[model samples]
Target chain A: MPFTGKVLVCEEKVHLRRLLSLIVKSLGQHVLFEAADGEETLLLYQSVKPDLVLLDVNMRQRDGIQTIQALKQIDPDCLVVILTSLVNHLTAEECLRLGAADCLRKDLPREEIAVQLARIIDACFGDIPA
Target chain B: MNVSDQPSPMDLKGRKILVVDDDRLNTRIIRGILRPQGYEVADADSGEAALAAYPQFLPDLVLLDVVLPGLNGFETCRRFKSLYGDACAPIIFITARSESEDVVEGLAAGGVDYLPKPFRAKEALARIRTHLQNRLLLEQLSKANAAKNRLLGMAAHDLRNPLASIRGLTEFLRDGTVGPLSTDQLDLVNNIHDASQSMLELVNELLDVSVIEAGELKINRAPVSLTALIEKAVYLNNINATQKHTRIVLQTCDLPQPYLVDAQKIKQVLDNLLSNAVKFSPSGSTITVRMEAGANGCSVSVRDQGPGIPKDEQHKLFKDFGRTSVRPTGGEKSTGLGLAICRKIMEAHRGTISAANHPDGGCEFQITLPS
Candidate 1:
């Protein structure tokens, strides 16, 4: 069965946001939303209440960590997967400890990223929960 | 470069030479030989005097006599060694003790060479000149090497962000995420994309090397499954395999025990080898990944069906910027620093990585981690 859910991608770069939107669409009949920074992401999270969030770590104003904290405060059940090029493992782990769904490497080849996202979608929306 | 024949006297002008001799006659004679050659000479009547004069004179070289009035030459030499540490200026012992035993003792005491007593002026001058020249050259080379590393680190770091942006934008163009194009336009965009990706990989690898060399390579070891790591590496590498129309086969023996490793770094090493196999092999070939368990340790090997590395160039494969005669089958580019980084990461894990020609054909790269 094709996985379906709402995904909100928060990235500072417009191109990355657009690309991630495209990948999320290619996955299934999932509704998609995009945010440029943490503040915008939280405002959208309040209104949209998307089933999934694709967060970037390094951002202006508030970062992924802060945004995730705010999102959890709103709804602890919120599913978020980090999509970043962050080389620092410690930061990634900190996000995980704050209840992140998973962390994906942005530096990977496009197909590999798509495959990983697909796997996450299966686990998140299918029989298995991530 | 004969010690006696080469350095012009002017080259070492004003180089300080401390004469640590109790005899005033011997000090004067040595000064007469060195001063005419443009050397600045300072004399100490005894070992204690020489140690006291050291800080003020800051001599480039020291000439000590073994048969001193109080402190022995060997003892003084040892003291000098302790003061300067590794880059201590050359210490030549001017002593009557010319026995093989004395020469060994002098060297063992950190003396550079022995200028036996009753020495000819020419021999003393030659020895002094050679050592001084060597010291100056070593200092210069070390300075240059450090400067080069600093430059490399900065340049690589500066180039990375912009290069990543270019790669991302070009990838968007190639994927038609931005817009579609004609065949020729698509080819141009694809070429640009590939080039940017190659440069991005090179820059990233250089950054990894510099960061590790800065002594910041912290290996966070955990009980990781090597078999699972290899499986993921294959899954990721298969994207390249699909692009090249090659098949990747994975074989494994059950490794139930948890093997300690930094999962991310080991994955990097495996990825490099698997991608290399993809890069060098023919389009319609097969790549094999195997994980084995041994009594001493566990091992992972990646074998490619490409032209085996030539015996002569095999030695160059793992060295920094090392390249071989074979070219990538698909015109794929290598960072050249990939294997070098892989070797470094393995070394951190107390593991070893090696490459060899497989008996069937092509080359195989294997890494072993001690259990």
Candidate 2:
């Protein structure tokens, strides 16, 4: 059974958003939704109800902290993985404590990042029946 | 003495001066003298009154009389200094006691300067202006320095994201994440990866320095084996040393008991020292990491067999941006901030880091932590 789950990519930068969406797609047959800011991210998430979210910590209008709180409030069990270049220990810990599934640095080696994402996706969508 | 020395200070408004004199006449005289210079004067009849008004008025400079009804000027000055320490406003004792000991006593009590009784109008104004000017200048400098640190932190943070992008994307291209790359393309990708990686390291170092400068360097201590940390550092540095045909010989003389320390931070310090040894050493040379453990304290020293730092430049080793004339043999980039960061980390751990030339060969950097 192939898991074609919805994954929302929330990032402000266009190039990074594209790269992240592609990374999510590389995992499996996943429906990708891209949002440039937190507002759009919430709108898309509400309308689409993604199985997982790849959120950037820093954004223009609404940042990751506020957005993550709102997301968790919307769906307590929703998996929100923080993909950020804000590569600080404190921020990562804060995001994870705020119920982010994982806070991965964007600068991590591609293979390492791929493995982490694959594990997260498999956990969420792998057991789905055909 | 020229009662009318002609260095008139320019008028600046909202500059508050606190006048603490038992005599109402003297307070009025100081007020009359400084009002023309655009100083807002507040009067306190006694040392007790001055202390009471200090919090509200927050005067830039204080003119305190030695004689008071209670809590004499010296006592008040001492209390202010002890209470506020370095942040206490500059105090100048203006009193009838013109004896030389009186001047010394006033200064010893933390008064920045002293003005005699029946002070010359011009001289009194000049002294007040000087102290007030110094206080304002110091405040400006401190604020400017803090702002600079903030700007450095922000700029470094902003650079990190794009740098990460460049580094990650380059590696992905080289690793064939999307598609396989040709030989020439792979070479270019490697170049880009290396460039961005070094740049990222520099940016991170800058961030560390700024954070430390802003007094945000935190040490989280946990039980960590000193010997194990040293071994791990040696192993990590060896990976790069092997590429240059250099060897790191770790001589852990004795195993120390596991102690509470920020293990990650200690590891970083060790990594910096060992890598520096590897970076500066010639190919086919041996870099020795000798750890000496004992009851009172333990020290780990990284000694490299390359050209030692010059006597003149050695003193500059632990300062930020302290780049000596000594060049790396393996063409590895030196951030020059590594030692500075290492020093701060050591200090936070209540340890000390020092660099000195070995008798037999190259420079040795050692860090010692008290047990």
Candidate 3:
């Protein structure tokens, strides 16, 4: 069994989006919306109201932190996971404080998806079956 | 006391001179020697007076006597050193301190050269010329170091982002979240992932060292939230933390305020601190991370329950290639670059990082960055 909730995937890079969408589909989770950058992330959030968001930290127009802050401000319950390759402790802490659901390094194995998704879903939206 | 009376070794046609000595005779003698060279001269008989006149006079050189009535010559020289660092005009000690020991002391106290008792005015002029030339060379070296540091920082930054992107892609593919991955395939991915991460760390350290060399490296300054940074750092490093069965204690201040800092750089500093804490601590011991505000800045401290840093070796901890003889608990290969990078990053933000054995019998790494 996999996650059934609607998930909005936002990443600046194109290959990442395709890969992320594939992962969500494989996990039995719905890819309710997709965004290439921060601007699109925000716009999609309005129309899709995704139960989850996978956000790339560095993006054009608005950065990951600003986008997360804005989305949280709008919904107050937005589940946003910061996806960054350069995992500086200071930035990870900042994203969490700014109301990000979690901060995930982009380098984990595909097999570890369920474990990570479970942890984030539990951390942000409370312990519930995804 | 005319412009042509003194020896002309001093090319003071455009230079300024400050005469600092409590003795009326010494002031008069300095004036007699320098005035004739067309040098602008200002006299301050007291340390207090010298400080008051220094900025106003903007002298090209200072003739300080070692035995002043108050705030003696050594103290005056030290204050002046602080005022201008290595960039200011040379302070030549034209004093009556004739002992070899006294001469050494004067030079150590910031005097570029010591003209002992019964000094010829002509010789003093020659010594001043040499000091001025040396000072100019020292200033140029400092400028060069600053420029070098900036270039190093730029190189580090440029190399890091692409490495991160590559690491991210590797991570995305390895996780098997996009599809399914076999156990053997996953193991291979893990190895690749770890190697890339290690390379990433090395690249960061290289950048940090470059910044330190140039002395122009500083932490990015902005309003930062500590709680978020801490959680993220701890989480990222949790695997290592778990291997040691170490627990992390995070204590936020009563009124946690937003600190001004470049968040990414500070996080690197914090990660290094935490990594060191976990590395050195005994298994099952607790590592406490606390954030508090002080008179000058906000401080984050990582206290580890491990063998403390020996006092003798503490001074060299931040030096390039300076590593403690004590090895990591699990025989973890230390790049020996962590603390050096930590110090450089902290300094870039006008902050400081220091380590000490905690009173409770462990090691503590404390970082203070201005708010």
Candidate 4:
């Protein structure tokens, strides 16, 4: 299997961030970055420039919508996937309109999340790394 | 006016009542009839005075007489409705005439009820008590409904995050990502993962039910192949069937290729039927899924080689939290919400689901969708 690119897991909860990091690391040989809030996510996006950002929709400051907007400004091609506990179609549609790759429910199985992230990564980066 | 008995303290306590009558003697009689029952009474000799006192009095009910010095009862009731809308208190018109036209006109003008004059204290009190009780019940129901929605929202938001974390961490540990684990530890981790998965399923079902009840579930309809959908549902449930040593076989006869439907919702219906079949069938039993196209539409049925549903319990099959005498053969967890959700989905798709006892002796669940 070829090396997948870097991923940034942005969530307010420490345990969730750790779990996501572990899942991404287990996916393949991939670099991982962590951010506890949208502010941290924006700051880290500049230095890390990860291929994908898993952003939590209900963060303390600068929630998922704001973070996605700022990330798009920084890099038009940046792939941001929303992580939310509530499965709301309206919120997902709004996130997609704001340039999010997808909005995923947090309650989904880890394997399913991994599969979705892999698909998004493949679509964004293709087989050959950029 | 002879007051036979004092009104029940329970019936009239804490109620504010406004009595509008041009006759001061009538107002005095009403106060004598109500004040002893722990009621707060306000007297207005004319419709004009009633209107002036209503805002300040904030009464729970009003007794308005039609023959007032100014602004008669019907017109006063209409103005009261305009002022307070549905929030206006219940008004019982006190009139001298019992003519149907007068009653109809009073009702049309926003009076909830009418009392014929030469007022019998007992009848008047009885009507007042009934209306107040009904209004109280309606208020309580509305409040309870609002609270239920709030609780549902909070549960959908707060419960899933922890459940996701637990499932993820358990899977992480089970996969031996951090280090090797003993067989015992691995089994424990697997159990935790399964429990979390079941909880997640329950939460999702509850969320779906709430959304459907709120009429917020949106279905994106398209032409979807019924063959492909059944194959996918069977594939998804293969592991579940295998665990219970059950085999699922799909049989189709003159089935339509594709139907205009919401693919995701139909898939959910299929998944629910397949899961129920697998959950109830004995080990080594065969479950056959048959699809047939008819003049009206197409139907898919899953027949399980287990106990047939009780004839008496058939009507309860599609209701929320409906359970039957048959138990899950594989000790699988069921929230008793799967069939309810399936029924709701089918209703949304303009389809139908039914259950019956097959002649060969088992329960068969069927779903029919328009072609």
Candidate 5:
């Protein structure tokens, strides 16, 4: 079956946010919230409690690391996956340590993105019906 | 002054020299020898006087006597070094003793050269000239390297944002998110997307080269299946190969599984070789990949049926920006850094990458990794 849960996309770029929103919708998921920075992401996370959060590492005011920390504080078991163009090993490791589910590159192909998202969805819920 | 004995015009123009000796006769001899060569010579009778004169004299070079009344030459040299740090001028010690132990002690004390007390003027001048020239060359080299790194950083930082935007917008249009498009429009948009993606890859490759040159490229080694890595690389390059009607054939062999290596970096090496094979092979040609296990290690070769590299130009294949006479059969754009990056990765892994012309009629690029 299709995913019936909410997702929050926290990216600073408008075009990237729209593209990600489209990809999530195409994968049969609902994007309930969108955030441009860490402060907005934390505020949205408090109210929406999205099943998944796709966060970018580079953001204005606050960054993905701080935001992930705040999100984890709100809910210890929150699922946040980093989506960024910066291919830094240290940042990826730190994000994982801060309770991120995974760190995915923004330059990944659409098919790969869909497959990764589907895998994440499967882990959250049971296997989708054939 | 005899014409033959006169120093050359460029020998000592605007050069400053400081001579330190407890004997006034020795100091006078040094001044008399260097002053005619157009050098501004300053003399001191003791090590303490030399240290005091160092600040105001600011000589380009120092001639120090080993036997001083106070703060012997070795101690004076050490003190000057600590005070000047990197800017410390080259110091030549003047000693009456020519024993090996004395020379060693002088060198250990930070003196770059040792001049016997009865030193000839020509020899002293020659040593000074050589050291000054070497220092100048070193400074120039370091400055050039810093400037190059700065330029690379700015390019990587500035070019990535616009390129990503272009790629994102092109993908949006091509995916029909904006609207439906004609077949030709779709193809054009696809080409635009490919071009932008290639530009992004070039920028990333340049950044990798800079990182490698700066000795910061790190590899996380683990057990990885070679077969799986090769297959993944072939799959990644399948689209480009198909565009040119070229087929990549992977020849499997019974090799050990889960070799210790950096999976991501090895995959990069494979991807670069396969892509190069595809770019240089003619349409409807076959590219072969073969792997074998030997005593030294495992070797993987990618052979292409294209115009082989010329003998004279083969040495330059793995060098940075090394472009051979053989051009890409398909009008593909290359960063000219792919092979160089591959070489660096292989070296980091204690492996080797080499290219040779196949006897039958093509070029073969091989990578050998320690098992």
Candidate 6:
């Protein structure tokens, strides 16, 4: 399966978002949109309608897990991957149970990030860019 | 460690009693003895019936016949003790045999007291009353200890959140990342921020030691980039370094990749050590920091060209509030807890810390934290 569409990368910290966005772009995925928090994330998701979303679990107002719940209520086919620095088991389990595609801790190298994002994008779109 | 207002010991009302005996007349005799003292009484003819009565009657005390056939009173009492350690209400053994060995065996089987068949009813009642009193006191003491620990734990957790917030705000101020300030005011603010951070560090150390003493020191761990940690510590201490015209050089060896650890705690340890190095080293001298990888783990060393730690004082360096004669080179204030805190963090990480004079000159503080 190959994905040719875009991904919505939602994070709060400027440094983390910059580093992660570089990794996402290097993986050949288009950044359809970016949001600093969950409210912005929801509005962006509705407007962009990207193929996938990379979410930071700890965000202001509504968190990624709550945003995932809210998004699923609108679009059940949403593919959300939790992007977080802290990899707590409780959060990981909750994300998986709530229909997240997978969890990727922030410590991963750029290459691993690319590979993981590629897999997730392919899983969503059933194809990838050549 | 001391609770100013401790509660009084609890009191229990006199409840019912169950006396088990194979003989009907013997049971009657025991019932006659207890009935006069406000104790409602019941009887069971065998060990099986006595155990069955325990669940139904839920008696506050039990008198058992030691000679009952098939699951004797000794076995029944042992089972009762297992089900309830000191809180089995009160168990007294009554049997015809008065041999010293028989009495010893009866008490060993969880009988609070062994009474001869013709036991004095008044003495038996008094013994039962005393045992109940003791058990209530013990239960109260255990509850108090548990509550004290919980209160301390909550206070520490609550204190930490604000301390963290304060540290974050101070760091933002020191870095001038939040707003603008004049050169002199910036320096003043930096000093104030550093002092606040030192205070926060001491509070955190106190909380950590309390947690350790309470046997609640568990690491919340993650994979940590050693390079990143060193850089962050150096960045945090840059203000002091620039003030003294001193520099901390982080030299990287051909070490293995990053290791797993509690990054925040380990960062605190590194900051403590580096702060000490900067404080002790003379102005314009360089503080050398190097990392090395080993078969089991990794080690980080911070060396400063200052008067070395005296051999005699080294032994007491890690004791709480213990200070060495060596003062800070830049007139910096120390809480006298930095080394002790470093040792505590290393021990929690299942690692070790040591200080000694480097062959090149001055003293070197080394910490080997496990992966």
- Top TM-score hit: 2
Mark the regions of model 4 whose C-alpha exceeds 4 Å error after superposition.
A1-5, A72-79, A88-92, A101-105, A127-130, B1-132, B135-139, B358-360
User: Model 2, range B9-113, lDDT digits (tens) per residue?
Assistant: 544577999999988887788888989888898999988889889999999988988888879899999999998899899999876754778788889999999
Between candidates 1 and 3, name the one with more favorable TM-score: 1
Best by DockQ: 4
Tens digit of lDDT per residue, candidate 6, span B69-166? 78888898888888877667678888675566767888889787877767687877677667656666666777876676567556665554444444
Residue B124 in model 4: lDDT: 80
The local distance difference test score of each candidate is 0.84, 0.85, 0.76, 0.84, 0.84, 0.76
Candidate 6 off by > 4 Å: A1-67, A75-92, A100-130, B1-10, B14-18, B28-44, B48-62, B82-90, B95-97, B156-159, B175-371
Could you tell me how far off, in angstroms, the CA of residue B99 lies in candidate 1 after the best superposition? Answer: 2.5
Once superposed on the true structure, which residue ranges of model 2 sit more than 4 Å away at CA?
A1-6, A18-34, A38-49, A61-76, A85-99, A107-112, A115-130, B1-11, B45-48, B66-75, B95-98, B102-109, B253-256, B293-296, B359-361
Interface RMSD score of each model: 3.4, 2.7, 4.9, 1.7, 2.9, 9.7
* TM-score between candidate 1 and the true structure: 0.61
Estimate TM-scores for all models. Answer: 0.61, 0.84, 0.54, 0.72, 0.72, 0.48
Judged by lDDT, which candidate is best?
A: 2
Which model, 2 or 4, shows the larger lDDT?
2
Clashes of each: 0, 0, 22, 0, 1, 5
Docking class of 5: incorrect
Model 5 alpha-carbon drift over 4 Å, by segment: A73-77, A87-89, A126-130, B1-118, B121-126, B231-257, B284-286, B358-360
Could you report the DockQ of all the candidates, in the order they appear? Answer: 0.11, 0.41, 0.07, 0.56, 0.20, 0.05
As a whole number from 0 to 100, the lDDT of residue B97 in candidate 5 is: 56
Give model 6's share of reference contacts.
0.00
| Error of model 4, residue B74, in angstroms | 21
Ranking of candidates on DockQ, top first: 4, 2, 5, 1, 3, 6
Query: Where is the poorest 10-residue window by lDDT in model 4 chain B?
Result: B1-10
lDDT of 4 at B257: 66
